[model samples]
Target: MNWKKAMTATVAISTCALLMSSTIWAHGYIEQPASRAYKGSNALGLNTNVGSAQYEPQSIEALKGYPSAGPTDGHIASGGVAGFGPLDDQTSTRWHKTDIKTGALKVQWKLTAQHATASWKYYITKQGWNPNEPLKRSTLQEIAVINDKGAKPAANVSHTINIPSDRSGYHVILGVWDISDTANAFYQVIDVNITGQGTGGTTPTTPTDPGQPSANAWSPSMIYVGGDTVSYDGKTYRAKWWTSGEMPGHSDVWELLAGLQ
Candidate 1:
């Protein structure tokens, strides 16, 4: 059996199946414009605070035991680049804060029901989206649990996510308390891409929007990705990738990466 040939074919097939749109560039890059809201910081920057709220709740390394060698998901040091970690529980009951002067976020994850009976839940918020005080019990935002894989619905499987039109933070949480008693109950990957738009109804000031050309816009020369593996600094750790087409549902084969053109 041609193992090498088989592996090459597998990757190609996976990429194709993951991306069905003709407009999406294969391994292209998207540039973030300068900010009209905040000065100095790139109009847009990607972030996933390690051990912070930005990470999927139950899927952290210490919790999931995924490999931590590279800048991919599950790598503690890699996440250091993006600041991936559990977040301090917010005291604010109804809202979280996000600095969207730059871009909005898309989070994707893979899930498997270890015991064939497990269930998962997800939520989103911003850095200041929440306040230290509680709100009317009904005002607290509820984390939506996704159980459909792919864009279409499936049985006992769920996937895909969309950011709220006005939410501050984006978050995903998975748990098997409803399915398995043991670990290794499921296999999945979590991917995220930060694009220059938010539910806040605002766009960057680039001459043209990213993935497009416009006048007086910051022509994106190139964007560099630095993560925990390259540097020990916790401030810049994060995994990077690219994407195209509409946002992916959790079960979809492809989750857009930041490097996507």
Candidate 2:
């Protein structure tokens, strides 16, 4: 071929390659606000650790539908918090997982706007807890922040966290500080989705679920009491309600939530 023709062809191929790469990169990302709140019994959840040596364990909890308030937000119920805080300084909640390969690092939950302060803390250990001190509370490594100022049912917000290479297995603690003088604030925890962060370098194993169909898919949708159904395109699917471990952050059992859709 003539030089002019060859050069034209090269440019066209390069442009197409560049476009394809950008599309792939843009498509991969973890999204919060999991599609559909969990259904079935209240006993379904999962746990994930943060940082370098991160890992996860499966378990179960009897989660009622996503917490709601006087009114409603979207399909979920709504409520407000004034001046309420945890009775015990040390507290615990469920865990959500993310795939670093996909560059996914967003965490979200439901809460009321009345609460003035919303924050996400991370930790390898519980805060304010001490063997000698009866009031020793558990300590957590603070990683991200959330803003919930009103009591909107399913009011949602998200934040990015710092996961140190050395820190393994991370969980998000959703807390609401005092609102006005009442100091009573309310928060709800539900579908948390981790996407995009799978190691792009390796061949990932598709997640699987037994009772459910094998080819399920997930979208930017959420299910409250009745799960939002989707298809799973990965390997190794497991589900359960995770809890505080017998050890600091360890647990057993995969309660067989639902297969990935």
Give all TM-scores, in the order shown.
0.25, 0.27
Q: Which runs in model 2 stand beyond 4 Å of their true positions? A: 1-104, 112-138, 145-154, 170-181, 185-261
Write model 1 residue lDDT over 52-148, tens digit each, in one string: 2232322322232222222233332222223232232223221222333222333232222123323333323332332343211222233333221
Candidate 1, residue 116: lDDT = 34
The C-alpha stretches of model 1 lying farther than 4 A from their native spots are 1-106, 110-117, 126-128, 131-140, 148-158, 168-261
Each prediction's RMSD over C-alphas, in Å, is 19.3, 23.2
lDDT of 1: 0.26
Worst 10 residues of 2 by lDDT: 52-61
Worst 10 residues of 1 by lDDT: 27-36
> How far does residue 47 in candidate 2 sit from its true spot (Å)?
9.6
Best by TM-score: 2
